[model samples]
Every structure is written in C-alpha cells, then in structure tokens.
Target: MARVERDPTGDVCPAFEQPEFQAVRDSMKPNPPGEPRSEEEVLRMLRDSWKAGHDKRVEDWNMQVQRDREERERLEREQEQQDEEQAERPEGEGQKIEEDNGKKTKKVYFDENIAVGDTITDRPASYTLNKLKLIEYIELFYFTPDGCRKAQKESRSTASTETWGITQMEGEVVGLQPISALKLSKFVKPDTELSWEEVMLGRHAMIQEMMKLGDEVWPVKVVEAFNTMYAALDAHPMRRQEHGSEATVKYQAHVRREWYDRQARKQGFNIGVINETLLRSMRDEIIDKKKTESLREVSVQGFQKNLYSFRLPNPYPSILSE
Candidate 1:
C-alpha cells in the first residue's frame, strides 16, 4: 500500500495533533484553576528571582571594581608627575604663612588636630576663644585611596576642576563643640559655683537632666558660667594633654553611619537617600552607644527603599484571548 502525507490545511497542525503534545504543553503551563502550587514549586520560583537579583548586584560590583582599578592607575601616573614637579620647585616659593611683627607664626591647616593650650595668635579670628577651650570630638571625613581617585574621576566628569591634579589629600577634619562642656552648662545655675569635681561626677546626672529637659535652654548666667569654666579648664595645665599642631585624632574601631547623619543635622543638611553599596557599608559599621548618646539625636531610618511589585503584561494578548 502507498503511504499518503497529511493534508496541509487541517483543523490542527500535525505537530500539535500528536497525542503526547497536549500533555507536554500542559505540564509546562502554570498551575490550573482550583490547583495550588507545591511548596517546592514556590521555593523554586523564589530562588530564581533571588538568583537574578544576586547576579545583577554582583555584575554592578564588578563593574565598579574595574572602574576603581582604572582610576587608581590614572591617579598613580598623575602623582608621579606631581612628585617630579615638586622636587624641581623651590623650597618656599609656594609656601603660605602668617607674619606677626615680622615673626612667622605656624599655620595649622585642615586635618591637623587643635587641642587645649593651642594658641591662635591670629587677630580677628572667627571664634571667641583665641586658644582652644576644648579639643572636643574631631569629626574626620575621609576617602580611601581608591575612593579619592573615584571622587576625582566623578569631579572631572562633572566639569569640576578644583580637585583636578590633587592625589594625596585623602580627608578633611572638622572640630566640633565639646559634648562635656555642653552638658556642664545644663547643670549651671546663676549663683551655683561650678566645680570641676562636680562636673566629672555629675556627667551622668547632666545626661539625665538633658534627657529630662528635652531641648537645651541655656540662660545668660549659665552661658557665662560655661564660658568661664571652659576657659578655666583650658588654663589649668593639669588638664592639658599633648597640644599644638599634632595629629592626635584617633577614630573608634568602628563608626556608625548614624554619626554622619547627626553631623549632617548639625551642619543643616539632609542625608536623603543613599545607594545600595553605601547602605551595605553603613550596616556593617558598628558605632559606640556612648558616642551616639553624646551626639544627642534619636536614631532615624537609614537607606530604606520604597518599592512596589506588579506583574508584566503579556505580549501576545490576541493569541492568549483566542
């Protein structure tokens, strides 16, 4: 008997008309009505989604690392050129100084720590105290070697030429007001004599009082007493540690991201939202509670994402409807 091929025009395609086709297709389709997904199936879907996100994050991190590597190389080349130029330059040609009656006073630039007994002979200074009353907490903002190069690269891309050709200056220093002095002012009454011993002993009491009072309200007398006591403390040689143009700033083992937020508040700025990389870095940082408490601001949420999810529309709507 001679074999005959199936007709081209048929109710269903030959491929779809096979007995095994429907079973294979149905198996690949989503769970049917009245049927719930198994735990294994749900877990599989979740794992797939997580894997997709993980892969994306890893890709981003790798790209960033590559960019960082390139930036470092560029910076190293620039630094070598700068060192050569520096060597050729005259000793004091570009030196900046302050002259008082023909006597050169040492100028302590940024990142240099200023402690008590460090006299500022410069007339018409911004601060009231000619000599530092307290060392306080030195807020140091730093960029790592890689971070500095990255920042420079970004600056260049943004048309900022100020940081151009700069390589070695990795950080800045900000001297904040003394927390102890601020607390001591709280305990001061108009007629109450300020004792150093009491100031040390009542440190805890001062904290309690601050918490109880809520917002700080410094009276005129209290302010005057604070200034007096602060000045007196500075004058006392016994209380003075190593002073002058010394880099005495030592940061805690691990700093909290909230510390920057608190500083931002003091400086009158908002932290707003940060990127995933920064958010992860912040979480890893562990700050001392004592430092946070001294900062005097309640913790606020950091690096929170506001997100929503929805299913994508099917592309073949006409076919699906049919």
Candidate 2:
C-alpha cells in the first residue's frame, strides 16, 4: 500500500498518511449485504442530475419561443394579404364603400322620367264630395250677419262651428269674401252616369297637389269651405250694408283680417302680415278654384309674389310688371 504523509497544516493527506489510507480502504470495503452510497457521493450525483434537468428546461423554453415567433410571422403575412385584396377591389362592388368613421353610405337611384315644373291635378265626388260641399256651404253661410249669429248658436252644439268660427256670420263673411269666389266644379251632369272611384281618385290627386303647394296657396279645403258657406248665405238674403261705403269697406277689411288670424290659429301657423301684392298675384289662380288646374301653378305665383314683396330689398321692376 502507499505510505501516508503528514502536511504542515497538521492534517493527514490521504495519499501520504497511513491512517487516512486505512480509513479510505475501510470505506471502500464491500458490505455483507447491500448498502447505501456515501453522503459526499450521493450529494455529487444529485448536483449532476439537477444540472442536466436545468439544461433540458432551458432548451424546451427556447423551442417554445421559436414556435411562437413563427406563428406571429405567419399571421402578419395573412393580414397583409387580406389588406392588399381589399385595396384591389373596385367601388360599389359586393364590398360597400365605408366612410373613415366606418359608416356605409347609401346609394340613391333617381327616376329617369320625373322632371321639374311638372303639374298634377284631381277631382272629387259622392259622400266625400258631399261632406266637403257641406263644409263649404257652412263657410259661405257664416259670412253673413244673420248666418254668423246662427253659426255661433249652432257652434255651441257642434265641433265644426267651433273650428271654423262660423258662429259670427257677418265676421266670417267679411273675412272670407276676398277668396269667396273660389269653387269646386261639378263632377257629374244632372242625368249622366259617372264612376265614384274616378271622382275619388281625382279628389285625392287634387288634395296631394294642394298639400304639395304648402303655405304658398290657401289650402284648397279651406277655400272650398269658404265658397260653400258663401253659397248658403246667398240663398238666404240678409240685411245688406251700402255697397261702397268707406265705413262698410273698412269694417269688411277689419273682419277679413280677424278671420285670417282665426284661420292661421286653426292651422297652427304663425300670424304674419299678409303681403298685399302677393295676395293680388295669387288672386286669379285661387279665385277660380278649378279642380282641373294644378295647385303648383298657383303656388309658384304666390311664392314669387311673396318673395318679391317681402324678402327682396329692391325687387326687379319686371317681376312686379309680370
């Protein structure tokens, strides 16, 4: 066996000291049966195994990071392709145009035949015609003094009188007289056959045209009522004032203004000063109240008159001359 030696530190070196060698020899000797490893050896083996496990975990983590990077690159390429495809598409295709704010704009289609300045007309008949006729007659009756008093008395029992201010017959008459000449023409002859449907259709068309005219012309319905009332009053004679007296005319004007104010209230309109020139321009068109003519013509005339009369600081003389 190799001789063991003592070092200056006062500890025996295993290679040189006999006692230390003997201890090593004893430790290496085989046991009678199986035995566990020495503490130092077991600790060394555990440290080596832990180092191997640590290296494997680092490799797995690097592999996962690489896979994620590859997936991210693939997604980026796909997104780029989709963007290019969308950009290549034409407008108004299956894909709609979107505003920057992401709202889709609607496509509007216009009818080829519809043009500006076209006129439409209509007529009326039967129960509908009868009802309108009755209202018109009542309006006419309310224009006379006796009619006005009767209307006021009747109004207490009827909603129509209240709505129309027909109770004050003289007042209604004075107010509505300027436009009283307006009338709806007859739809049928004394013994002639006629279709109610045709009459109704005509009436519907007339109403639509009137509505389209809006405030430009007095409502056709009101005009009809005024005419009807006047006719009724004409059938029954009432006390008459001197035809051209200043007082009588002045009173008529005042009543007319009052009636107009009342009408404005009923129609939920602002009571503005009536433009005299515009009223004169519309006079002929409205006065006739022919169902055959388009309300648009009357409206255009009225609008031009009002515009020239009220809005323009100095309208061209030609407009007034026309």
TM-score for each predicted model, relative to the true structure: 0.23, 0.20
Candidate 2 segments whose C-alpha is farther than 4 A from its true place: 1-33, 92-322
Q: Provide the lowest-lDDT 10-residue window in model 1.
A: 244-253
Candidate closest to the true structure, highest lDDT: 2
lDDT of 2 by residue, 1-322 (tens): 2222222233221232245444554454444486755645544554566567666555666666677799999999999997887778885542554443377568998989978666532222222233233222212222223333443344344434322212222334422221112322222121111122222333334344335445445465554553433233233222132221222222223333456556546643222333334334333333354433557788889999998888545568888788
Q: Estimate, for each residue in 1-322, the C-alpha lDDT of model 1 and write its tens digit.
A: 2222332222222343356555644454468675766545655555566567666555666666677799999999999997787677788543432234367669977655855566422121111111112212221111122222333344345443322221121136344432221222211221122233333333222222323333343234433443343333334443333321011111111122343345446642222222235423333332344457655543332212222344578999999999
| Model 1 misplaced stretches (Cα beyond 4 Å) | 1-34, 90-322
Among all candidates shown, the one with the greatest TM-score: 1
